[model samples]
Target: MLTIDTCSSADVDRLLGLADQFLDDWAEDAVQGGKPDEDYEQRSTEWKVIRPLLVSAPTMFKGLKEIARIRQSSSDPVAICCAALARTALDGFLIAEGT
Candidate 1:
């Protein structure tokens, strides 16, 4: 439920939290004996977690989609990568806003 109007530090925090959780799930999935809920893609921005962001944060969404396309085409998928993309998108938005 991340809309442009309601976007704030909380949104950023949510993004970071999602990133951290994905990282943990990835680690557990890799280490064995791990029962992580939902798969990797599910936890990404592509899912319901930030569905509104798709329109609310179109810039970030488009960038993420492009990266996803590129990575899926060529590149090893990383658990923390989505989070990094989110961070980068935020950075880019901030820079563009001049604030």
Candidate 2:
């Protein structure tokens, strides 16, 4: 449910690439219980590798807003806009976790 207000097609591509990479890393970590660098304390604290992804959330939210506006002419504009907004909010946490 992630959307981005990308300035250009290149930004959209970059965002998707980053998302894919994050999912791959998360899947691998899940299979392994966690990353190799995860010590007891580190595991208990915040995950450091995901910091960059966290910073990208606002851009993604803006993107979703743009998408909702673009689709506003649909039969169910409210539903569509609400869905887009929901996706934007979820993307905040998902991107934060790099998932």
Candidate 3:
């Protein structure tokens, strides 16, 4: 697994933004059981942070009709996946950014 000596505030902040973006889109979709918009790229910085969240979000919200499910649940496999992805991002972002 990739690992980093430290995580930057920018990276962490971007990660949080990514997380929030997903939540916002998901909330919009939940309002009427509609699907989310899909105009985003797979290679952008937001996408880099949002990718893992998008990939695992379904599993994170499965069998639940409301976003409250996420708040009420104590354990979720998606959380584990996100944790792993966050670690990988911290370690790999430098390489990914060619720094």
Per residue, candidate 3 scores C-alpha lDDT tens digits across 1-99 of 222324444455666687768866755655564553454332234656766764553344332323333434535777555555555554454586456
| Index of the highest-TM-score prediction | 2
* Model 2 Cα lDDT, one tens digit per residue, 1-99: 433333445565576577668656765765576445444335424434664555665676566666666666776767786767766776674686576
Instruction: Record all residue pairs in model 1 with backbone atoms less than 3 Å apart, i.e. clashing.
Output: none
Comparing 2 with 3 on TM-score, the higher-scoring candidate is 2
The lDDT for every candidate, in the order shown, is 0.59, 0.59, 0.50
lDDT of 3: 0.50
| Predicted structure 1: clash tally | 0
User: What TM-score does each of the candidates earn?
Assistant: 0.30, 0.33, 0.30
Name the better of 1 and 2 by TM-score: 2
Candidate 1 lDDT tens digits, 1-99: 555435665566677677667666776775574654455546643454654553356455556656655655544557358646756876676677566
Q: Model 1, poorest ten-residue lDDT window?
A: 36-45
Model 2 misplaced regions, further than 4 Å: 1-46, 74-99
